[model samples]
Target: MWIVFDLCVEGADGCEGLAIDSTLDHPDAMWVYSQGNWTHSTFATGDPFVYVQLQEYGNVVEEIDSDSLVVRFGFVKNMPTVINSDLEISFGLPENDVVSLKIYDIQGRVIRQILKNKTLNAGYHSFSWSLFDASGEHVPSGIYFIELKALRSGQREVKKLLVVR
Candidate 1:
């Protein structure tokens, strides 16, 4: 699913407001508009920022002074439902490179290293976890974050997973 929000500020008249819009495609796709443009910020599993272009039509001579404008886009992935005890998260890269997948607790402590500096192929890949700590002990039911870092592209992706008894 895709969602977007737009906030417009008129420098000419000192007007400011917000506009919201969203769209969804059948099966598994979505599109959202922000600041009079479509955003692709949440396209697919590991896609980057969405491209957008803005155009304004007005006479420059009418303005008394310089004005400023700003735009922002954000999105999230709806992870599939999985048993907390059998929770396993995985993603693939576009090229063969070193990737790291780490699990961190709410206290910002490194609980386990699911994947560590492993060279992977360019395509879809995944990893599974049994929700256990480094010492082969089951952790308490709570929230956790899985961090994916790619060295080649210098990209970092984070996904949240839940564990319940």
Candidate 2:
């Protein structure tokens, strides 16, 4: 799974100061810091595209099988109505794309961003949520929604979740 993150590099002619500062070699933090320059006709023609290839750099810690589920809008909707603790969400991706999974309140406010701008393989994938808000505090018992969206593929899925004490 490779994701292409681009910087327009558009600015003044003397933009030699523009550079991509990468501190960590990890795939998740491939490009930590980046400086932009001018990429238009004034500075240059055609923006330079960077296709970053995602690589696995650790031992297999844990794995779960989720082959039975199907991809609906780049995700599945199978979830528990009421839960005592964590929630498991299962979904499938047809192809490699930038995926983001977020928990939203009933009023359509983002509660927690579980996954953001992560490169996921094309297959069944699962994520466990601790039902906590952005501040790491446990959410109140109520209704929430899981929004699975693929930015590149333009796919989105919204499913409801009920948390109870």
Candidate 3:
């Protein structure tokens, strides 16, 4: 993610000698610090603009066998009701392998295996979760973690998700 903070000031002489300083107030804002330095531009009418740019970096991978696979997961319904929330995960594999997708609580206990040892080809695939446990019981509303693992490739990926009751 890239954040560009623009500070613009207008004056009779185009904002000459104007200085803008910024402080990050949010945890996500910390990503903007990696941009190193910011440049300021001034106009003849005493107007000035300061820009701060930052870059974000991260990798999400799902192991479906012995290879590393890229994956994406999210909640299908942003605002889900107690009986209709769903979670979705999509991933690509390199070859035919057995893949497993599991949901776990924050305590690291596996709640259920949404996808078991299923053989998949080297292509894109997706699965949707109905927010139910292994016994067909609905889990309480809260934050949960999804773990994707490929047994053949020895690769693994994990992502956080939210479930609303």
Q: Tell me, by lDDT, which candidate is best.
A: 2
Residue-wise C-alpha lDDT for candidate 1, range 94-134, written one tens digit per residue: 56668888888878888999878887765556577788989
Runs of candidate 1 with Cα error greater than 4 angstroms are: 1-78
For residue 45, give model 1's deviation from the true position in Å. Answer: 38
Error of 1 at 78 (Å): 4.9
**Count of backbone clashes, every candidate in sequence:** 0, 4, 17
TM-score of 1: 0.50
- In order, what lDDT does every prediction score? 0.59, 0.67, 0.59
Question: Candidate 3 residues 29-135, lDDT tens each?
Answer: 12222223445433333223343322322223433663454433322223322333675567766666798889897788888998889887766777888888888
In candidate 2, which residue pairs get closer than 3 Å at backbone N, Cα or C atoms, i.e. clash? 9-37, 9-39, 10-38, 11-38
Whole-model lDDT, model 2: 0.67
